[model samples]
Target: MKEITIYLFLLFAGVITAQTGSGEYSIKNVDENTENSDFGASFYGEKMIVFASPKKGVSLVNEVWEENGQRFLELYSANITDNGELYNVRSLKGDVNTKYHEADATFSKDGKTVYFTRNNYYNKKLAKDKNQWNNLAMFKATVNENGEWVNIIPMPFNNVSYSVGHPALSPDGRTLYFISDMPGSLGKTDIYKVSIEEGGYGEPVNLGDKINSPSKEFSPYIDGDVIYFSSDRPGGFGKLDVYASKTDGSVFEPVLLNQPINSNADDFTFIINPNTRTGFFSSNRSGGKGDDDIYSFIEIKPVEFKCAQMITGIVRDKNTNMVINDANIILKDVEGNPIENLTVNNDGTFELHVLCETPYTIVGEKSGYNPQSKTFTTSNEAGKITKLTVLLGTGEIVENEIKPEGLPKELPEEIVKVRPSTYVVNIEPIYFELNSSYLTKEAKRELDKVVDLMNRYPNMIIESGSHTDSRGIEGYNLWLSDRRAKSTVNYIVNKGIDPTRITGKGYGESQLVNQCSDGVKCTEAEHAKNRRTEFVIIKM
Candidate 1:
């Protein structure tokens, strides 16, 4: 008999909103946020987002919940922008927006089915159990071509005796994840999941002790096999904090998210699009305009949650064997995407707290020197220090001709210099369309040359760095360039090339061939040189 108290938000809904309490990333409230609580954001379709709020944008319902004096929560839908902002706020269409409380919803992959949370209001009346308790329940609905939720039906698993709400569907739309306070719950609430289909539902299974702490756990969101939820358990920032767990069969090991995502106040209802690495979460942290506010953020770095280690590496000049503290360092994953990039420490040494059992590459770059790279793999053991070194050197550009044994026959035999002692096949320049990351047909044609070359040389490794002209916002240009590099690398990987043999990153507008500075007058042809993508042979 858990009572709806202040900690539980008086039955308003699952977790919501965030503030820049620590400011590691950019986060702002949704456009429709008001003085009342606004939280529980979920994607309804490709271009729309549906969330729970009391703003009452276009709904006719006027009833207020006696439990808290706030208007009953209603589901609202809005257009999502390319930058993850919200607009065109309106009440969701259809009879699903009832007079009773409605919050926390999840949609199927095809955008046709939705599972939502509400009070156990059935038969046009409130349904209570023998204990005179109004339990929370979940409902199923279908979306019509008109964008309205139709065919509303109570889920078969709903029971008047216990509460079940905060629904999230699995990425494959095969299982439904949710929070409940059923008979065997470990706390006031626990996350549960069950196989679901149009025919019926399977028995709910508790997520287990790892995710279900003795304290309350709610607001579950699933992306692939990973689950994100909010809990008021021990060892958090303070009060409720968002936690993530990777599921291995029925077992899970939950890890607490870092600050800025979790603050001293309540933070929950976390959701993310893995492709773009952008997400939204809810929080009641201070500095927000309302009781709770939804926040949108871009992931500057991905959080790793495996065995940990402290990796130390040094950058130096290959010829002089002297430390180079001012050199730029780029850390890459096995697949060759930049994981972290920065200048090494003043001591010429850089340390990274990284995941164990992973392969990594470190690239050292200096203005006057040719780029150099070193690759290493972390051990499975934790708390050990490993050493790696990168040395950069330059050589005179030579016009001599040399044909490597495994080189493609079509490539010109003319050789350009490579890091003091190598000459390799050249890949044509890869360019992109304006403000776009998709690979143009010409870019693919050039990439195929590199792919064929790699297939011929199994020992060779390459790095593709994409650049953008200094035409748009600097930050946006960087993000766009990263996308372009990723697309190019992905295309090669899809064609038989091993992902570990290639890595890439976007340099954005940082490296321009000419002095096409932002404030300077420059021709489109000159700027176009800055938009080119370069694929350098890192190892051969």
Candidate 2:
């Protein structure tokens, strides 16, 4: 009866199918799953991946459910190796673990609070409704001073007549989405969201018809503007197919994830970090060590955004700090193909409406001023104004030559010539520490000079280009340098500089000024020369 109750109560937990595909994604099964039923994987902090299993894991107490001849599910986290292997798997500490079911955990941004799915059992007792049927309930816990999760409590919405489990939280932690067969559900089980507020949980809001089918919709995971879930709806490749619905508050159409990721089995609980385009999902497709397994996927091709957006730009003189009425602005795609030509008004502002998720560059040129270009990317979101500021009439400065008197005098030769018109801030080549994107103290101090320079030159706009010495693989260096670029931009933005005034790009080993290309024997100093932060003066 306990095993039967647990399986039925796990309304959303199930299997997924798998088939091979082209370059869009590459999928591989991980060692997180055991011979028993292991599923419900979520990233727990930086170094650990947490999930649930019907095996005695972290807690020493493993209570088997006689009906299935297997132990009930418990939350277990394992260390993730650099090469993406699982190690040192252990059950989660604290009263959160129980003889009943505990799974589908989501962590808050601060990592202070955790919410998970557990059987109605709590406090050493089983909770059954009027018919003696044990249902699933959502519970919350917090880490004590000793780092153990204590203070376990069921969510206020938990009820005896209905089951609520498979919890997923928004990154902000303000909205909690979970699967339930509670009152007013559209199907046997539907995904519902409630506002997580200061006082208590807000009223549960149904995700509505767009996402909920008459069959079922469960295992909801939010990644940026998209909501991922699985359903046995009509037009899918398997019994359950994972679908991505473009959601920005209101729901859009649900697009099924294609072959390789979804097969004729049950695929659900998809989670991803959009920035890295790498994530984990669960599937029971064939060739697994268990009934269901967690698989890691890497997106070789990014999902395209179809939403339209408005991009605007304002052109001004870098030296005079005045709007240029005769400025010419050309919008080009990431590949440098011209898409739209904008005519600047006498007021110096131009606007272009285009689709989101594609990177564009705005080139501003005037008869007297040197032509300049500013690059930016649009989003899949709505009502956002992607704007750019073009500063013209600033002549290119020679490396180690044009030193503003206001700059710190100790660094007189503070520039490096990257290109004809591009100058890189040569305060230090290695702006970030080794193997890390975090800005160092010296990097911050040098960036302080940039904040001051921008403050002095109101129309001044700069582009931060992060570089890497040819030591690591191409993909890794590109990712690391991109992180470095964003980190530097964030620091300056936090210092009260307008985000629009600064931009960032990563040139991983592609723009090396020295002979330290990959496989080339070079000293640490020579490599450091190639691994430098390029603070290029886009305007002024």
Candidate 3:
């Protein structure tokens, strides 16, 4: 009784015939009598190729079905003419046939190579354990001279101990898409891709849950940014129908291929030829010769948008202007869109990728220097490299000005007298880290004050001093204080201050205003007050 039921089920499965019209298509001269012959895929404006079995062709028929049996499948290809007519139909040579079950072949856009799946069609006895009998492998072939394919190599990353098949190439040929039964798949079979990198194929990335369900989804083809694959999930025209997906950046969302395109049988392995509305695919449905056969369809082309643009620039000092290597450069879009920011190379050059036609604010910062900022807009018309040059200025100093604050009121009138030589001037604060020589924010603020004073007095020479608190050993404090004072002078020099009129000195612990000295316990704040850094205007 079970045998009889299986025979009836096999008998009900049918085939497809030649179809026409803008969106209508069919498989021609398909020998449906052979059950294994099915699922053909091709791109528009390219040769139509498929996997099907012939009764007496080069396709070897080793294993035969017993339910009113004698069904075999092999891979075949047909040259599609410009007018959408099929011609020069022939079976693909080498690695394509194994006297076993082999069919379902897809070609790259240039038609230089092919990726297809082949199961244990050669394994004769269907062991009691069906799981052990379902192992399949995916293979590839590159076209050689004389227009024949050679160099058949098995795909590396997508292969597994179980099965791997149904390969697709992206429009730009930068990605390889295929189906596999590897672990972590959402279904019995799932779609996956491996990026084409500089050295070789990159690691595989799964199509994720959106496209592959607990059911089966396979046969992936890429047109522009859209991915057209096949799936047997629910809500289709039939058993296993074709589905499409749109990819934005790195994300892909599935879109069902509805209506007359998908039917109540198994419709899959579809390819869309670029620039044309026509495409070639495969299906196993009723209304024709036998079990499974090839089919074709037509679809509208989709619009594509640009993703990003490249920007490059250099950072240099304004005074003794030299390129500052390894300086950090940040670019942010108006909405604060951030990408992988970069730093200046050893040669002081940096590059960044930003969205086109977007407003971006940039900030360049480095140690021991003031932060620089600028705003810029990027557009598609601009080339990959948009050059942005930046020059950092140093702190400034002023000369010949009266001391505004911190003056002694007890000084005699004669001592305080200007004598026509009192140069009123302000010194910019050279920033320093807490208890360290590293520059700080407060330091830069002091320098700005110095810059203002310089604009007021242009001819006075200025002297800067470095001092340290008495919390530590006098020797160490001396070196730290000296570095702090010199750093202050360097800041002013970089800020356009005249080097000839300025001097720096480190007092170490030699000078002290308060009684707090080494070994004298005091609060950090009090110690900090003792660690204070001060700058004085000598000749001004």
Candidate 4:
């Protein structure tokens, strides 16, 4: 019923803003070109990566494209000195860069990997065949032991559908969110997410109507607890504007940049200088040499704060103990505020940083299995690093028989149109030991359905509710039910859904779809049906 706010990235060229107070943005032009243009910037601490002039002598090739009447730009990278000067700007060499068009470079949190978008024709018969027309797929390169990047590969998420580009890696390097105009999109392009699995990529999920519009939104960045992206939606300082949004335990809403920060020109593709709190973005406004130029700004800093007690770890199966890909992992405070949401890779590992000296709940889950949730208190502060391990069980026994009622029959018109195009994540149920909450093989079978659901709705919120038969004492049953429900939620949340979206509720034999009571002889099938875990969409 209410219109959902979305963000669209607009490409422009200009510079705006002056440093406030004593804060100074160490500004530098990564590329020096008086006759050409360069932009689309990304940062990894001090090092910088971007795209720039593709003219002869400046680039390895000598070819360009004129969109409206001019040539499209190329990609480049540079290093930032300690004093903030950028130099050694050069075109990306090797087989990755053709003479067509390339831009938007991103680095992994550990700075060991790089991902960027390229547009043009390449002769990759196996890889580039998906989108032959607009072969704008994403590619990656990893830092080798010799300190040089090697072995570039195309991201698996790209296909023959629409174009995919503008990839941004999460601070933990476990999640990657990018833009695509694939078959399922609310607008010209939509933001999508996929897990970094064992050096590969899992399936991609659309970020939903909240972050995408009928216009266009691109260049996403995930820092701390907020997501920053570019858009040309209404009420902007220019043809394209920058916006910020926070994870409010549910969906997100666009928060426009304050006055003076956004101009009436084209401003888009921005990155924050992590070390200095300064902002670096690109624009196509006046005073620039060509179509676009890079700019820097100083952000208004709040009261100073530093993180403590950083928790990091790996997720694996209890038996056979292999890394489970795309497992949801979550860290939350006692009040249910999500501290971090992480998804494990095919290698079954994750990392999280937070202010310590408090208590926390760590949870993990995958499809076709039961969740694994545990509690651990942090005595370390932000700087203190802690490592932990989590194990999950597959719920194979109960998955085949357990089937809930159908989904809501009535659907909104807009939802119906987009819903079919969206992914449907399915997690199987968790099998408990006979008459016990302890997890078993059957439990994991059911949990897999939950993982599928999460993959389907990257922006939707979920609530995990636990139920039980009327067999034990009211108090005991309530506690057991709570544990069961929490256990289910923990498995997937730990796999990496926002813990805030998932809260466990234990009815303790309060609500029953069937009649089975305490101390009464009942068929195993009847009790099995009563012992259940369910999830609901709280926000779209």
The candidate that achieves the highest lDDT relative to the unseen native structure: 1
Model 2: lowest-lDDT 10 consecutive positions:
396-405
Off by over 4 Å in 3: 1-36, 43-45, 58-68, 120-134, 158-160, 249-253, 300-540
Candidate achieving higher TM-score, 2 or 3: 2
lDDT of 3 by residue, 411-457 (tens): 42212332222322334324344568876778777766665565555
For every candidate structure, what is the RMSD over all alpha carbons to the true structure, in angstroms? 13.9, 13.0, 27.5, 20.7
Q: Which order, best to worst by TM-score?
A: 2, 1, 4, 3
Per-residue lDDT of model 2, residues 1-540, tens digit only: 443243663344333344332226778888767777777778777667788887563534347776556777888988877656688988899889877778889988777899998888787878788778788888999998887899998999999788888888886678899988888989888889999888999999898876887887878898744688878776777677778775553223466777677877777777776556777788888898887788878877644333465656677788887888877788898999998776799899887776645687777888977998766665433334555667787632111234323344343354555432345565655455567888778888888888877787777678787888789877678778878888889999999999988987676766666677777899887777766676876565
Give the total clashing residue pairs for model 4.
89
Name the lDDT value of residue 334 in candidate 3.
77
lDDT of 1 by residue, 97-162 (tens): 877778899988788888898888866888888877778889889988897898889977778888
Cand. 1 TM to true fold: 0.55
Model 4 C-alpha lDDT per residue in residues 1-540, reported as the tens digit of each score? 111011113433343342122112333432453445566768854666555555445322224343423344556667665544467877655445555556687887677778877652335442334333445778788777765556867777666555778888876687888988788788777788888878567889887765677767877877644577777666566666767664221222465665344567766787775546665677666766666677666665421222244556777677877777788988888876778787876677677765545677777877876887767665422234566667778422111111113334554322222121121223443435434766566776666666666566566666566777777666567678878877888887777777866677666675554557666778888877778766645455
* TM-score of every model versus the real structure: 0.55, 0.56, 0.47, 0.50
Residue 135 deviation, candidate 2, in Å? 0.6
Candidate 4: which stretches are off by over 4 Å? 1-33, 55-62, 68-73, 81-84, 120-132, 145-148, 247-252, 302-540
Model 4 poorest ten-residue lDDT run: 395-404
